[model samples]
Target chain A: MYAFEYFAPKNLQEATKAFNSFNDSKWLAGGMTLIPSMKLRMNAPSALIDLSSIEQLKGISIKNNILSIGAMTIHADVANSLDVINSLPALASLASGIGDPQVRNRGTIGGSIANNDPAADYPSAILGLKSKIITSKKEIDAGNFFNGFFSTSLDTDELIVKINFQIPESAIYLKFANPVSRYAIVGIFLSKYHDEVRVAVTGAASCVFRVNELEEGLFHDFCSSVVDKTDYGITNLNDDIHANSEYRRYLIKVMIKKAISILQKK
Target chain B: MRISLTINGNPVSEDVDNRTLLADFIRNTLGLTGTHVGCDTSQCGCCVVHLNGEAIKSCTMLAVAANNSEITTIEGLSNSEDLSAMQESFRRNHALQCGYCTPGVIMSAVDLLKNNPKPTEEEVRDALEGNLCRCTGYHNIIKAILDVSKAG
Candidate 1:
């Protein structure tokens, strides 16, 4: 790991101030991904501004019919929070299925969404529920927040404050996880509102994207029989050693069938 | 950088490199070798420890990130005169052969029980997913954790 300067800022103001001072500093949320990336030399920031001490960015609450989760809220907290379970149980289930017990304890929502790894689970939740990424400066729509694989519209040094998740009438998240890393090989998050349905697919593409065709079909019929009607012939799809593009596209159908079955059972 | 934290019921503040990991600080700086670093990439649970009473991968957390948090290593669990209930359970179940992952497995199990007292067999297995046990094939480890949960 590269030896870099570190600072733990107490508040948002202090954190921003620290970021401005360092030329190439990274905002540290949970350090679950950043630290590991640093150890592997995949990332080499000159300095780090640890945001764990920022009190304003750590919580979960439901107000005004929206589930507002502070960005620094860790996965374990989300998994165990009564409010999350009561309001968005599918989101909680996704959180509980992340990496492992220890990783969930340290990995935060803000970091996950900010890094925007293609296989990350939070991005699907954000895009599927049509959540809003509340930054330190402004509110960005989930569609605009994610740019592509490991990319985001977040400005450099602009920190995410919280995320406001739209409460769906009912939703389900299903993932074919890599056994070792537990990252989603092809995760599908299906959310149904009163009049609209949202289907978000992760790990199968270069970005977490909503399947408009699937959503349209589900909006009309809302059943497993036709959930397989997807346009997987798209030129670009994400594939790693764990799965090939062909398998991922096929698994999408399998997962959606399983997801629709589970949703009906509920 | 200067970091201060309470470990094993003792408070210690020391100067450390900005990039030093919590696992290195515990093992090399404080001479607490009980926390093993089987895989520095955070895949292995050999570096598991309690950070603010929650189990976390110490290898993935910087020492400075720990800051003022409270940490509990395997050494902090009990003294020579006494073994923790989880440890005693592991001994009774013969949960280890190589014993490389035992410290982390014990720490992770203790954290699991602290949160969920009576875990089923499947729950115990799920909780230990982070801790890789090449020996015993994790049958006895799960048995050990389940036995403690039942006793509690």
Candidate 2:
């Protein structure tokens, strides 16, 4: 990688103090994406503030109808947490399906959400469940948190403290995983919260986006019957070496259908 | 940078460069070559190791950050006398051929069994998804992990 001074702070306050003192320093969370980018010479931060030591960033808890997870919580923690499994089993399943065993063990929820890769699985779960991104400064809604590909509304100095999701009556996540990276080729997260049915589609677009048409159809029927007749064209989907835009669009519908079917079965 | 941690049930202290990755530190500085490096991009789990008893890609972690944590490498799996149950299973089932990917696979399997002692075939496959083996495909590796779990 590039030349950089690494600081391992013992707590969040110290980490934030060190982070705010620097101009071009980056917080190192998991480093699944950042380390590779650095190895390729794409980014060379002058300093790195390692947040892995901050204990406040790792945990999961559920209170009332809200499921709260610390930002630095790893996929393995989420996958194994009884609290997560009891509150939002779909989220746990999504975490378990991310990358592989090693990645799940190292990759942090904060890192995944902050990077906001279009093919990432957490964005779909956030968008579908209408979660809130609680940062050091403000609590931003999931809709406003994501801006575009590898982009978010988070400021450079801001640190993601925790994530909160409303407990939906029923939810399911379905993704066609890439054979190599295990990233989602087309992931769909469907949730029924009270009277509204929300559908979030990732991996097939520039970013995880809400499918209003599918949501409306699902809200009306809440079954696979409406999905059979609905037509979701591959107009704005992403095309790459793994899959073309048309295939992603097809997978989106297929995954949504699968998610709804799974939800109905439960 | 001076980093201190417990490795293979022993306390270790080493002064490392700021840019040194955990995988490099383990293999080069400590001379624990059992942890291999496959794809430095974190896509492959050839450098998998147990950080505080949980399997993680050592390539993506900084050596300095691993201070005060408990790390277990493949060399630590077997005692001075006998092989670990997982290692015996790998040997019995011929889970490894070139053996480049053996360390990571075994580390992952160790973590998998620690969490779920009796994982199903599909669960074993899912657990080993991060580990890539061009040799022997993955059928034998999965079978080895399953056999070990069943016997252990």
Candidate 3:
């Protein structure tokens, strides 16, 4: 990693002030992905503004039937939070299944969603649950937050503060993870709120996307049979060494079916 | 840049390059060579250590990030007079072959036992996912962790 100035800001205002002062700087949260990229010389920031010290950016709270998670909250904390487990067990399970134990200890929800890795787990949850991303400047709907591969609508200096997830009536996240990296090869998050159903698929494309056809099918009949009968289009799905586009399409169906099975058991 | 942190219960303040990795700072600067670095890409867990009571990949974290934090490395697990329970369990189970991955595996196991004093075999296996031991095939390591959990 190249030498760079470091700043540990205690609050959002201080962080943004330091961010604006530096010509090229990156906000450090968990440093799970950014640090490694820096080590490989893929990213060379002039400064690093560490946000771990901010007290307001680290917590889990449930209010008014919504689960508001601090962006700096690590995966392990999310996985172990009683509030999260009680309100959204599927989200807890998703947190527990990211990377490995060590990575989960340091990887933050904010960093994960901010990087917007195509294979990341949180994007699927945010999109499937129709959550709102609260940033330092404004609250962006999860649907409009993610743009494309490794990209979001966030400005360079904008910092994510918290994520507000609605308590869904029922939801489940299922994924086929890569053996080594543990990144989702083809993951699907299925969620239902009242009469509406949403299906978000990750790792099978350049970004986490919704499957309208499957969502429509499940809205009519919320069952595993509906998922089994639905046909997923492979027109723009990902094709890599791990899985071809057709294989990803197949995995999407299988994961949705698995999620439905889990939902049915509950 | 100058940074200060608690390492193994000792307060140490030093000047280091801003880009210095925590693994290198511990191994080279502080002269605590027990923390091994097998794969610097953070894929292998040979450099795992406790930062503020949680197990994290030392190689993946910058030394500056650990400023004012508490860190526990493999050396902190045991003194010259005695071995930690997890180390003894590994010894009793013959969990190591080349011993290259022993320190990290022990550090990770110690943190696991701290969080869960009695983890099941499946839990032990899951916790050891980050610490890869290519030499022993992980049977003995898993056994060692289970033994320590049972002893407690």
Residue-level lDDT tens digits of model 1 in B44-119: 8999999989999999999988888999999999967899899999999999999999999999999999999988
Regions more than 4 Å wrong, model 1: A229-234
TM-score (C-alpha, index-matched) for candidate 3: 0.98
CAPRI class assigned to model 2: high
Residue runs of model 2 more than 4 Å from their true location after superposition: A228-234
Highest lDDT scorer: 3
Query: Which candidate comes out best when scored by DockQ?
Result: 1
Clashes per model (N, Cα, C within 3 A): 0, 0, 0
* Candidates 2 and 3, the one with greater lDDT: 3
lDDT of 1: 0.91
lDDT of 3 by residue, B72-113 (tens): 998898767788888988999999999999999998899899
B19-72 in candidate 2: lDDT tens per residue?
889999999999999999998878678999999888998998888889899999
TM-score of chain A of each: 0.97, 0.96, 0.97
A1-266 per-residue lDDT for model 1 (tens digits): 98887888889999999998988999988888888889889999988998888889999989887999999999999999999999999999999999999999999999999999999999999999968999999999988999987999999989999999989989999989999989999999999898898888998888899887778888889888876555634447776788888888789888988988888888
Candidate 1's error at B103, in angstroms? 0.4
Please give, for every candidate in the order listed, the TM-score of chain B alone compared with the true chain B. Answer: 0.98, 0.97, 0.97
